[model samples]
Target: MRIEGKTFLVTGGASGLGAATVEALVGKGAVVVVADRNSDAGAALRQRYGSAIEFIQADVTSEDSIVKALDLAVGLSGTFSGVVSCAGVAPAERIFGRNGIHGLQSFRAAVDVNLVGTFNVLRVAADRLIKRDRTGGEEENGVIINTASVAAYDGQIGQVAYAASKGGVVALTLPAARELARHSIRVVTIAPGIMETPMLLAMPDEVRASLAATVPFPSRLGKPQEFASLVCHVIENPYLNGEVIRLDGAIRMAAK
Candidate 1:
């Protein structure tokens, strides 16, 4: 579906990949609802984008929260055209670590926020889109874009919980797309490799550089804008659905 004149709800839109996506969508003339728990960042985005974007404090893991966020999207823009599920958490902890056994709480938190949270947003957004009147022939009602990580496929040591969470996201794509097809909604997931997000940037310079060197081409961490660009492309491309597109620079990570 064309982005211009449409509205999209972006979870975790306050920062990182989600922020880039919100900006990209607004730049393309699409109204965006920035659903995130970061009220300060959300307010800043709303102030910067004015009417092009709306900010709603939302917890993606909560059904009531996301439902309200989607309602707000429609109330602000009159309709919901798509959603980009970027709300996630990545906690690196080995099952048996220097401290002790990996905490069950940490594992549950990762899965709850990364995997289940994605589905929470998707179901609510898809429901709204499916209820909308289609613009007629060959017109898609909406699209859902989810975020995974290259670790889902090539998880290194100390990434058990994170990998499991992201792996669930990748596994969810195909079935969701198939089920939503009857309503003209598309579901796709993106598995990004090492990226220049805050989590990676927090690493020491030498460490960061070492990681960047792993990428086969470009030999650098992926940019959030590149991720956002793919999201826009996926939305506009009707034939691209039910797939997990890896945004890594051909890097197959080795087990640490």
Candidate 2:
């Protein structure tokens, strides 16, 4: 569980929470395979972290790509201690509406990445983890960390599609934990509140302020590193399993 001297395979490691986790783990001496579709960012990360990190371009939505990334991970790291699934997308929609409602395609795309893609990573990584020998007889072999969203619980009016996909992720944690328990590998999810990602960061100052004001206290968007910290904690805590931890401060979104 100690991040130091271990290898972690992280999807979406080019940016946001994924990038932050890679930074934290690599900083602590953990070797990493930063798998992401964004080759530019992934390559830059490799440059920044040097030997401790290597970038792999893989689209999480494709099974073939996932397999490739997993192979690359094994090729570089020798063994993996953890798999962090941070690849996801949010597409807002309504199930039904006067203006023809949201497109089903949009909804399906969200589910494909946020939910199904997560499964691909988990299934692939857990398969390897189960077969691999435990480093120490007293503890688990590996960990799988998933990303959900606050919208799963408190979705806004236009977030039906996004919420459903995230809800699937939330629902998946328990079942995965149970299934993967025998191998001593833990499965967990983090449902984050609004974070200052590139999109949010691009908003006008007053608009961003308005969004921050919605939080109950410490009115500010969550930081990617804060979410990464929770991941680091879960990695080291053996007892934490089959749970979805909310990284939101105190704020719950109002129905928009």
lDDT scores in order: 0.92, 0.88
Tens-place lDDT digits, model 1, residues 46-89? 99999999888999999999999999887774456889999888
Best by TM-score: 1
For model 2, residues 1-84, the per-residue Cα lDDT tens digits are 788877889999999889999988887788999889999998899889899988889988888998888777766644578799
Worst 10 residues of 1 by lDDT: 130-139
Model 1 clashing residue pairs (backbone): none
lDDT of 2: 0.88
